[model samples]
Target: MDEGCDGTGLCIDTGDGEFMEISLHSRNSFERKKNPSQDSGFEDRGSKSKKKGLSVSDFLTRNLFSRKAKESEDDAEQGWKLFGRIPPKQAPDKDPQQITQEFQNKLRSVAQPKNSKKSDIEVMSTTALILENRPQNLPTKDPEEAEKHRQQYEAMVEAARKKELKELKMKKKQKQQQLKNEDKVVCAAKRWTDEILPNWETMKSQKKTRELWWHGIPTNVQGRVWQLAFGNDLNVTNELYEICCSRADDRIRMTIESSEIYGNSETSSEPPSSKESSVELIKLDVSRTFPQLCIFQKGGPYYDLLHSLLGAYACYRPDVGYVQGMSFIAAVLLLNMDVADAFVCFANLLNRPCQVAFFRVDEELMKVYFHTFEEFFDENMPGLYSHFKKHKVTPDLYITEWIFALFSKSLPLDIACRVWDVFCRDGEEFLFRTALGILKMYEDLLLHMDFCNLVQLLTKIPEDISGDTLFKHIDTIRMNIDKKRFNQVLAVNKES
Candidate 1:
């Protein structure tokens, strides 16, 4: 027996019986041939049969192996997954020419008509790979590929440049339109100041003593009375009366009356009083204190009319009754138009559901506003709240004045006017943005200070900053907040 032969009987020797014989167990055994070649063909046929039998198994194994290989390749190809999804790669640091060309190609590919959807992944991967493989610090050789890239780049850049120019022009046009709108408002204000108001003065001055006296007396100044006694067409004036009567308190009324009686037309030779009498006397000069024509003034139909309207409004909306801040807002409107016109604007402002809801004292919309502020503070300036807590400063302490007066006391008149402009145009979002703007404006102080210092710094903020500066800062802050809030809202809506 040869060394290769098993103990089984299936062994065969070559010509001289010198060659080793190997054997395997056979399922069937029959002695057929003595020559090895004659038997070798039989073995070959049997091997071929065995191979044919394994065809399905081999196919399955190879299929699995290929699938595993492909999966491994995909994992390797994909860079690190961010938040369980692959994020778009940042554009590679590349020559401007190359970037422009690549960008153009991408745009062109996007523009190409295709029956099948192209995978964004494939396009991005190819672009990234191309950029990655590109040799850095290569000499400027004008290869055709490079030239093609250059042309594409040039085309894209030209397109982009044109788009930017178009956008700039649109923005310029929009800005011009805005300026025109503002100019119209200012012109209206000036017209009211120069023409409409002076005419009211003439009308009031021309009235009989009894009519003047009757108008001067502030009692029974109801909206209906305003409509009946004043110009019948004075809807704005009547609305103002309604709002004033609805919202006013005794203090505001007394102040307005006093201001009207003690006109500030003359230089004061005597020192003003410091007591409550002084307050009353100061109220008598209401026209001087809350100037701009609509709130308080003596001897003018506009004044009497507005006084009546606002007085009525104070009475009508007693929950917000007599906030000192309303007068300032009213005054701004009055400066811009006739009392009737100003009242209509004010009505539009206050009658809005949001403003009306906010003004309800029992409902305490201010609290909701403070909650929004607290949330903002927590997210953007987390330390501020903790600092405030450490310093024992409640939300009411600072936020009350800011919210109640809409920062009238904190911000200068002009800036407050701009805020009101946006507030009127946009709505409640403007208020939050304004608050954020205030915080951001004091960002330097906010960044450096701990809680105690934060409180102190906020408390000590000067009231003298330019309104323009304040508005500009507020606009910037508001823009950021608007963008973030818009995205958040959009995401939430999408999820829903």
Candidate 2:
């Protein structure tokens, strides 16, 4: 027998010198010969009357052998597709089983050597045969469905981007709104300068003017408003400030020279007067005041201004003299106004009756203030009031520093300014009210704290307290201080 195969299918030869082809290319490869016995030289085994398709065993027997016995081994092997070009890739749409079976049959047709015995060939698994014969480019998913998923993912990303952009836009809009409110405040100040101040006797009595001051003096006009509030009743002027500053400079220079010569103690055997003590105190406290701000340190921008202001005030008012907390008041004023105006305001501020009594450490006036505050505290927040009494926590511990500095030390700078606004407008009564408001605001927290914690909390008040929230509680409090008694106490102290 002879055997060969082209890429299409197998071919075989029997001793009759004729060839038969079993084409596997497609259905067209199955065209029958006119006379099967003559054309392919195969004996016609089936009866002509039957005319049925060949069974697998009969088909194999007839197709495996042909009469082309003279064909060379190379020629026969040349048509064998098992050793030919790579198999065509299976079409993505073709039935997988049909393709697998086709390749399986094609792989089973290789010829054996003439000397070797023919053993049955065991065909490989359908998956292995298909993988070996077919190219590795089969599609794992439908093309249209993959495109749909890609578009969906892009849409989700775009939506997230839009959401992020929207949030940014809202934040920017809120910031713009804040700026607009600030502009309104600036515009209101302009009206105060151009319209209101010229007719102050009339404008001062108006409800609108009172309301404006209640909100705040705008930052640009704070110096003017402060000067207006405290008034230059003593006719203090730029020239007087210069003269006082000149006098102060001389005293400070002499003191420094004396300290160098006599090692800090005064050369005179007599005790140092308030004037001598004040100059040294002013120099010592200048660096310590507002140390965190850096503007009051030795080499700071406002250092000379603060030093000069305190020195001038101490020299300008030898009667009131300089106290421990005086620099805090002077420093706060210097921040808002020019040196001359700040000195004028500082003199008038300290001249206020309550300020005089407090700075002088008038025992009688302080007792009155402490007594009044205790009454207000008991009235406003009885629970916290009882707690403080139990712990021996008294107003003298905290309110003294608060009122002395006008809360410039106890509260945040901005909130202290708000307190100052009301203090300037409503007078010392608001100070007592503010103390009550603070106690009421932290009543719950204070009620639970022990003695040390209570003292610490009230003295070193936390910086995080909200000004708005505190004032909201403050507005609700209706404190009725005994103004007549406070005045009598302050007046009696001043006379002595």
Candidate 3:
């Protein structure tokens, strides 16, 4: 709901304790920012989220972008480090040269679905009935008391009906507006599709693909862009992917044959081959992947595809085998690319020179990732870093999945995909940049939290958050990380 905390905690009551909160107000704060100096102080405002429990907005009330009273220069620098540079000043809208501009042209042709205006009809007279606790001694046998109870029940029912009707109308109105947004999205997607695919050779890297990606990739065209960002063609990548899949298929048959002939019965001399064991393990994590999304429902085609991709990768790179978080990354890739293409991308990611170490659980290279995260956070956001340190909230508690899954598991889908768009183009620093981005977005709130609340709060992806908002910081704050230092940190730690 809220964006960022302004480094000050506000006292709030929730969960049976008095806690201090220092987070941005929810979605409404975006509007508050439109008129930053509206003269309404803290008491007139509270969080705008309908989500139950104490929200992040109880304390973060300042408009990081308010014009009348802008944040101090230091705060502005910190905001940039956390979220990206402030948005450019709004240029006054000029009269369109033609009535049919791109966004307007896309929507101008679509008629609003019929009866959409009926949502505004008011059911204005439902009286809310308040029925407080009464003594048990009151006799229901009394006619007056019985009649009073009956009226109260009827009024309550009417009130509930009124509430549901109002909400339903609101949902319908929102859906209509969403359809309009969809048209604009389609128009924009068409432009991006033209840039990458049909004209790949011209726009591959000779253009500002990174800047374009940072803006946001149209979901439909994002996968093709990802391939181009990696400087590979679809044909070559698919070929390598298919080869890996064939090898894994062979391995699977061998594993099955060995199992059938050996008839383990706890008496076999050799244990199952690594590939066989990995298949069993992969099966376990397969179902756990994106259980919430319809596309990844258990026993579905997409789920099976995930099975195929992970199996291919494990067989393709025996040394790495399978890791706990690989399933998440593979699932997201499969959503955007063909199964074979997904496998190739997955393998390349694991085999990346610096990134490959992240798969080594609790090993030297893995430790390097954790160290690099700390160094980046310390360099960019020392105040938030010190607060995390003060509370003893270690990186192991949260950064593991972040490094390996690249926030696909914890952040909003669009946000996670945007991160991947950048990751494919920019390399490992993108991960660190996103890591810092998450912390920067939540630093003020985190400063006021204890360990349990801090970890829980940091791990959730609010359904309503916009990835474009999070990606803004990634573009503004350049995380110039050193790959060589990763090796240095590992070497020094090992010697110590």
Query: Quick one: best TM-score, which candidate?
Result: 2
| Candidate 1, run of 10 with poorest lDDT | 48-57
TM-score of 1: 0.39
* TM-score rank order: 2, 3, 1
lDDT, residue 212, model 3: 61
Model 3 score (lDDT): 0.66
Residue 201 shift from truth in candidate 1, angstroms? 35
Q: For candidate 3, which ten residues in a row score worst on lDDT?
A: 29-38
Which is superior by TM-score, 1 or 2?
Answer: 2
- Per-model CA lDDT versus the true structure: 0.50, 0.72, 0.66
The pairs that clash in candidate 3 are 1-26, 23-60, 83-473, 84-473
Query: Per-residue lDDT for 432 in model 2?
Result: 81
lDDT of 2 by residue, 1-496 (tens): 2232334444444335444545444332223323344445545453232222222223443456444433432243333243345336565786889899878877755443443322112222222321122245965556677677667766766666566566666776888998997898988889788877778778876898887877777777777777777787888888989998998898888877887788776475533434468877887888888888999889999889988988888777777678888788888888888888888888888888678879878988778767766766776788888888888988888889988888888888888888887787778878888888888888888888999998899899899998878888888776644544444544553466
Q: On residues 1-496, what C-alpha lDDT tens digit does candidate 3 reach at each position?
A: 2332343223344443323343344333222121221223332245432212222322232333334334443343333323434567677776676544756766855755546556465454444554544678864457687688878888787878788787878887899999987886787688777665787767656557545656667888877776566553333466666777788788778767877987544333333334567877888888888887866657688977887788877766677788888888898888888887776667666666555766755476666567767876787788888988999988878877787787888887777887887787667767777877878776777888898898897777457766656766555654544644434544565566
> Which lDDT tens digits does candidate 1 get at residues 1-496?
3332224433333334223222233321111113243345443332222111112222334347665655544444553432355567687689999989989999999998675433311222222222222467776656787778867766766666566666666776888898986765565445434543345545434434223222122222222222222232324555455445444445455545656787544333423221123334324434553444343567654455545445555454444444445555566556555565566666556665445655554355545555556666665556655666666666666655565555655566656655654554345666766776677677766666666766665555576766556666665653333456633543443454
| Residue 472, candidate 3: C-alpha displacement in angstroms | 4.2
lDDT, residue 251, model 2 = 84
Predicted structure 2, TM vs. truth? 0.62
C-alpha lDDT of residue 246 in model 3: 82
Kindly report which residue stretches of model 3 are placed more than 4 angstroms away from their true locations once superposed: 1-183, 201-209, 232-243, 260-273, 294-298, 460-464, 472-496
Model 1 deviation from the true structure expressed as Cα RMSD, one decimal place:
30.7
